[model samples]
Target: MSTSASQQADLDPASFRAIADLAYRESGLTLVQEKSSMIQSRLRHRLRDLGLADFAAYCSLVQSDAGQGERRNLISALTTNVSHFFRESHHFDVLRAELDRHLPKLRAGGQLRIWSAGCSNGQEALSAAMTLLDHVPDVARLDLRILATDIDPEVVQFARKATYPERLVRGISPDMLKKYFDQTTEAGHEPSYIAKPVLTDVIRVNELNLLSPWPMRKRFDIIFCRNVVIYFDQRTQEKLWPSFLNALAPDGVLLLGHSERIAEPERYGFTCTGPTTYRPCHALKSTARPEKQKQSEG
Candidate 1:
């Protein structure tokens, strides 16, 4: 590819708007004008792979009836998947502290469901699995499971594979790493580690678009949707709050990204318990919004 031709592959204004609209309608991801360059950079490979010369041709193909499958490809290309094991440590700490109360119920065969919404490459879900294992080594045999879902099928597949480069496991503690991961090397391939069966055994990874209807019938006890909603505009975020609340069990916890706040917690029947952490108002036995406590970093 020549330099000039590559540079010209950038999406034109019309094409950019069409893509942005399609992305929002399909995935609830807000692609503002400023993201045009990012879209161009990310999807430029699609043009090359399809033997197309410019963004116009790429746009036409994606917008046509035959482009249905490419729509998923487009989402996988544009979505960000930056995640690491225990990226936010405090949430796990809180979960650890609270597990005592939940363990007995779980031990008694009560179901304990946790959802890692937008679980990119399985780190967050795996981290939760490790936490559970730390407190209850037999958690996998109990009625406890973590549902890890991402909009990108590629990332979901990566999560299901449960393998990671050595560097990605840096945040894991030495003791935990020894217990939960098995390091291995295949000739000619980079050294990597895979989560132990104990971890993978209790987690289910699947591709799910949050904008579409959820097929889950069971509510979650804890939800980790960090950094997932920042790509959505306020209106879109507002629309999601109710669905999240509905998905959460009574007294269930909701964890959001540091920058993502529930704009109107009371409007969504949520009470802020800690930074980026919320509980349903009904669960607290009060309709009034509680005072916002200082949030811990997670």
Candidate 2:
């Protein structure tokens, strides 16, 4: 392609918005209006690599499924899966507290299950693993498993790798860092950081599309779907709440993003324990037959 033609391949705001809308409808994410700049920065290289003139044609190719494997690549490229270790610190604090309070009842058969929805690049999963180790004795001996999932397959692959640079480990507690991370150097940089054996104990990284059916039929003790629902419109959030509730065990705890909360918590049978945290009503079993039970004598 000519230089001029190559330069023309970059996705413009309108074209990006169109493709984003299509992806959002397919996936139930609402890319913030301000993300246009970030989107352009990220996709410019993809457009050039594909030799497509501007985003409109690229989007057309994506929508048409023109190539054998471009559609999935396109979806993966457009989706944002930004996250860091201990990204939202408060949620982890709450998580530790909840685990301490409920660990005994949940420790049946020496097993406990957790899920980190939208777990980008496995930091949160590693954090969960580290946190579990801190609170539970012989943590490696416990049958603890965490399911880390994201819609973006590329990120899932990266999560499987479980490597990170020093910058990504910022704000992580010093003791946890020394204990869980293996230091290494980058190609030209002096600093290097990566996950140690601690990650292997707790995280199970896999691909999962939140808008679609979850493969895990089993309920979880703690489900962390943080900073994920903010991208979805309220309607989408409303739809997802019930599905999340169904995925939870009777006493399961649900953690949402700091800014995200259901306006009608009662509809989902969630009781607010703190800001942005909820507990599935332990008394209201999903299978209970209220009408069939007789009242006791007064």
Candidate 3:
């Protein structure tokens, strides 16, 4: 075949629609018409990997029963994994407040659990671990655990590795960077840091699809489902609210990304405690609020 004949064209409209439909059905990801070009850009490698000529063939496989496993690959390719160490400092403040209220329980061998849903690359879960250790130096010996889950297995594996190159380590302060991570350098390569075992010990990295029923039996004390559901459409977002509401313990706090919010959260069993922060409607007004501090990057 000539070079021009062999070259793949842009994702055709039918192929985009088929892929979009599969993504929505399997993972609740919304792939709109306007984003077709971007979606194609992301999935082109899948075509190359399968030795396919175009998106159409790729789409065909993913929609079939035989493509069940490939559906996960499609979702992984489409899902966004952008994250930072202390992306929003206030959430850690909330963690500190919760630790204050819940530390006594932990000391008594009671449980305190935090869930970092969509924990792209481990920073969020690691940040929560840092906050916990800062509060109780021997927290790893206690009943506290951080459950970090993502739909993408690739990012889950990365989170498990708990290593970051310099670029990915941007949001961490030098003190925190030193305290939590150990720097490893190789010849002619940028220094990379990995989370010390103490930091990762309390963190349980798992592959979880938020759309699937949660396997965890224990309700969480704080749930950080941040910057995750923004890709989901309104109906999909609403569907997740009830699960989160049910997943939280009484007086439990739920924190969303600054860019995400639930309309009429009260109707969904949540009280607006702060911007994108919530408490169960049945909880006391002051459930997890320790003291208000002006937010700052740490």
lDDT of each: 0.86, 0.75, 0.86
- Candidate 2 residues 1-298, lDDT tens each? 5545755455567786776777677678677667777766676666778876677877777777464267566667767677887767777776677577566655665557899999988888888888778777465665778999998889899888777777778868888888878888768876867777766657888888798888897888789998888888989999998888888877677888777887767777776666576766553464222222222212
Model 3, span 244-286: residue lDDT tens: 9999999898889988888877778877777678788888555
| TM-score of each model, paired residue for residue | 0.93, 0.85, 0.93
lDDT of 1: 0.86
lDDT of 1 by residue, 1-298 (tens): 5545655686899999889989999998888888888889998878777778888887898899999999999999989999888877778866675566578888888988999999999999999999988877777888988999999999999999998888899999999999999998889878989999999988999999998999999999999999999989988899899999999988788989878899778889887877788889887774223324655433
Which stretches in model 2 have alpha-carbon errors above 4 Å? 2-4, 7-14, 32-37, 105-110, 186-190, 282-298
Q: Model 2: which ten-residue window has the lowest total lDDT?
A: 289-298
- Clashing residue pairs found in predicted model 3: none
Off by over 4 Å in 1: 1-8, 286-298
Tell me the deviation in Å of residue 126 in model 1: 0.2
lDDT of 2 at 289: 24
Worst 10 residues of 3 by lDDT: 289-298
Off by over 4 Å in 3: 1-7, 186-189, 285-298
